[model samples]
Target: MSPAFRWFHQDVSSRYTGLLCLFAGLLLPFAFAPVGIGLLAVPLLAWLFFAWSDASPRQAFRYGFLFGLGQFTAGVYWIYHSLYEFGHIPTPVSMLLVVVLAAGLALYPAAAGYLANRISLSAPSMRLLAIYPASWLLMEWLRGFVLTGFPWLNLGASQTDTLLAGWMPVVGEYGVTLLLGVSAGALVSLFRFRSGYRWPVAVTLLSALWISGWVLQQQNWTETSASLSVSLVQGNTPQELKWDPDARTKILNSYLILSEEVWKRDLVIWPETAIPAFAQDIEKFTQGLSGLTKLTGSDLITGIPMVEKGRYYNAIITLGSESGRYYKRHLVPFGEYIPLGSAFGSLLDLLHVPMSDFSTGRLDQPPLKVAGQLAGLSICYEIAFSSVIRAQLPQAGFLVNLSNNAWFGDSIAPHQILQLSRVRAMETGRAVLSSTNDGITAVVDHRGQIQAQAPQFIGTVLNAEVLVQTGATPFVRWGEWPVIIFAILLLVAGFVRSCYQENQPEEKTRG
Candidate 1:
């Protein structure tokens, strides 16, 4: 083995290896939003791969758990802001809640590590190269699906500004994540085989993965067509004051006055729940706005709750030339609605989140027509789901995301969510107009680049032009299947190879 490789494995068994793993995990979040040091993800993941490959299954689980604990604690610290600041939870309780959540998330990684080590591939190299990568991918998929799926701080999201981002449209977010695991595995293979000729081959494979990303960036998956001028309104309304009966009129007037300045624009968008009243109660107000938009030859989209058959839906409604409504499909747990409400009825009361009971929109809801084009709508957390956004493609030319991030205070949730929006744009090859209640409102181009962004905690308008995209990207068509399929194949191959090797040893002994 190379001297560096030998030294690294030696250090992995050192007394402070657990501490080192935790420190590495803590640094992983920096590779993502707000602080965006994109290149850090690979090396850190490689280090974790090394620790897992060298440890027993029990030790690997511990290492993975510690790494995940650090990752969630650092990356999702903003969750505390929502709980304590908006949910009205006490400081002590909020801190405890954050720790509990982080610990719960950590189990996913721990399970991945334990499963990978338990599989017992014939060779150490195969364990890292095939089994480990598949395990990680499966766990990531589980994290995004099981129990309503947190899906935050995904490794692929860290590559948003990197050359790898170009791969998004072709292979999707999970594909990039799988590739990162491959790169990390190849890197560890270099150390495992440094004394042999195979190490050079490992180095070559690692180089190709990154070099291919740079090459992919030059290709355009979707062509930009007509452009429409749009205005995104940031009301800067405090969460505490938004629903107050006395402040309702003032908040409504604030949006109207801000929007009037840009009334001539092709489209005007308001953040989620900007109306601060149910759609049934605000028909007259909506008609007035609709009339204004019609007079100006523009379309208006605003967020409000829609009441139907005693069920309430968190919806965004179109006014003027286009008339449509899109309710949020993937609702935020506790924040949007309580899960298993009958059994856990009082949990909502203790959490104190507002608008805590909203019915989910139908899965096949059509895209909204606006500004002379078809626009896919994702309210709040829905945009984070690639499948949800992909369903709109080949039909919707642009994407619109409306969010009320005031509940998160001035924490990093808005910036993190903005990063996710950019990745969605890259994945679908569509321009995204992300309108937020207080901050980080911006326009993201099909290339996943932020064109223009409004400052946080400001009452202002972000005026920009977004292009309409006509076709669908490969990711939009194939969805997450390709990546999931690839991972499954790797796991199958690894197990088959292990079985073959075991039989070979037995046959030689019998001969």
Candidate 2:
């Protein structure tokens, strides 16, 4: 065979391997729904082994990037639905846009792999196992924070149903990612190459850590407060109809009918913007609902549009209470408010979205008091951000997310958004109640498992007794500080070590 042909074949094989790893990572999360805990770790371990074998830093990065592309492509394929259905883009253009976004996201993982390779070059022994995992998590953290942050598929989310989920409340998802990556890397190192028993040592340590997680899972970390019987109303309204003047009554009636059936419950919740009108305009309607809440003695939290001082907000209003107003702080760019309006104002006209100039609320707004408990309210897109939720944790006993997923239609967007909410619930050790206009409305426990859920595109109400954890979890108290500090320290140490090694002089023997 020609040398050039051999090279091409080898490159294709490497890229294919990377793609497989990416697919495996994406599939790993679904496995938790049915597969045993023992089997769930196999794919991750395999990916780590692949990384270990790719001694070339460039090859390792390529593999990691391809893997990330596949994972995100599958996980966020629903993004195209929004572009096509609402953005009024051509189907092909919409698909291409989604692919480009996925590719940009994939870069973070590729960068992480490159950094891990650099660290491994310095310490190729079992020590690389620890450094690689820490560095990879640091990259994930950077990805979450840098440029408005899109932290969709952190590795720890895959273990939401496993005993390892117990670690979530203590360390948060980023920490869990660190632990999982380290364990996977150590396991790969232990068995893949003959390394003078160091591999065995690493594997034993990881096994012990896994056992520790099992023990922790059995412990009740927080005292549960009085369970609140809550009803989540999913209206299943289409995005096009949600804002239509003629369909306003239809949207309102849909939620009212579903909510009336469960008004006897302690609380009734509706997804974000379930009422597509401004608070001031809907005074009479809100008053009627308030009267119902008063009569039934049940608190109601529903999303609505609000306008104050010529500024619009995507907000949550609590009926039956004097303090019935909370505005969304973290507004979605383009969707809610356009950035750099001076330059992009014309783009809005092309996009053709109404109410694209929403304002942000204060960062330190108090949690909504509902059904005798303080519930943190994150409107739609805000739940994707950990810092926003972390800020609300101090005053909140549980979490409530109001989202209108109608824009994304019958797409995976709702599922992907729900997954992020589950991670937030696990991180804060708070029961999360997510109500959506088009569905995936569900209650996720502190351990990140879906306790109960309303299926997609279904006009239904889910009634359940959700437990609230009174005290704060470790994640809530410290937030992501520990992980951030650890990552910074690792990067600094790695850089210093690299410098020292590079500066070291080569000693000459007697020639």
Candidate 3:
């Protein structure tokens, strides 16, 4: 190698390479949806290949940790905005806390990278491709399940605008992530090969995958149902003013007026915590809305706090004769309910996020029935979780997400979150109606297309005829259990291969 080439290689070999790759991954999403230019994955796979080529498990773990630190530090920087803006934490404390939390969140990805490196030691070449992708998937699943589950920044989410998005309705986000990882590994393998012949073969396969995805995108898997006209009401209430004693009546009146305008629609929706008061406390208002619903022969679903037995719940109530309740199942950690109460209870009290001590509702609560159809209800933070939404799919014809995005201000966080809601809609083949406080409230079709949307910070009502799906996608029917099984099979296969290699030491020389 030339002197400059050798120097460049050494730089890439340093710990900074992983960090650089992660930063690239973080920033790439802002530039392009799906961020699939493969810049992030390329360096990431290169680091894994080099680590596996030479390094102990402990060393690999350290390298992976550094990579994760960079990834999360950049990706979740917006988290600190909430702490500083709403939690009343000092700027320095909020920054430090966000860094610590990001570091902790990085552990899952670090562990996945460490495992991939270890597995690659015994099974080099294309075998690592399978093991690495599978390992990443398993780690992501764990990240989503363990703790309160922060599945933000999943690789598949980056593919939202790409042709790969066609795979969403089938295998869902994680499956698309697995495919992305596998593609990355294949690309790395191609780069490692000096022979010109290998490049063409790899390129051909990648092209074929892209072509297939495009074909899938052109295919219409489900027909839209013309049975429902929905209006999503964006109250556009400011976060600071939302819970003010003096502003409560004004906030309530704003929603009431908007709801009145949209009452003629088959169904009307409001953002999460739009009422900013307990169901019992707002009985008079609820009754008035119920009466209005009956008078119009339409149903209204609104987000409100439900107090029961001294515990508060972030809940959605259907106001009409067929009224029912759906409490938010997946609460935001720290934002909604603080985890490890003994350790952080005091800190949580210091943070002034209203309604942070919410009680989780029963997992098996029935779907919200509105206008003769069952609507799957997912509150603000709840839509990020697939399993939570999956449980309600069997009975739900459409999905309704009520959110207060004013907490996120004008940041891309709301837009990104809304994208996840779109993915969920595709996964279940159900039209998603999202009503947000401070805009981006949209009516997304089953295919994940936004049919109508209100601009940010605008108090507006969006009217659209939403489609209801009768049939379920494979993902809706089986949920993450199928993905879990696939991950388990991959792990088992990797273990079996490892044992076989131990018995036949000669196979090691083949690579």
Candidate closest to the true structure, highest TM-score: 1
Q: Which residue pairs clash in candidate 3?
A: 34-158, 34-159, 236-438
Q: Give the per-residue lDDT of model 1 (tens digit) for 1-511.
A: 6677668667645676788889989999999989999889888888889889878889989999989999999889888998887778899999999989999999988988988887766568777777887888889888997988888988988899887887888889999898888888888887667566667767887788788899988888888889999999999999899889899999999998898789999999999999999987878998898889999998988899889899999999998797999989999887788889898779788877767899999999888898878999989898778888888887999999999988788777888999999999999999999999998899999889999999999899999988999888889999989889989888877777767877897999999
Question: Whose lDDT is higher: candidate 2's or candidate 3's?
Answer: 2
CA-lDDT, candidates in order: 0.88, 0.76, 0.75
Off by over 4 Å in 3: 1-11, 14-16, 31-56, 120-123, 196-201, 503-511
Better of 2 and 3 by TM-score: 3
**What is the per-residue lDDT of model 3 for residues 114-179, given as tens digits with 9 covering 90 to 100?**
776665345355454677778778888888878878887777766666677777777888887777
- Against the true structure, candidate 3 reaches a TM-score of 0.91
Provide TM-scores for the models.
Answer: 0.97, 0.90, 0.91
- What's the lDDT for residue 35 in model 2? 34
Which sections of candidate 1 miss by over 4 Å? Answer: 507-511
Q: Which window of 10 residues has the lowest lDDT sum in candidate 2?
A: 30-39
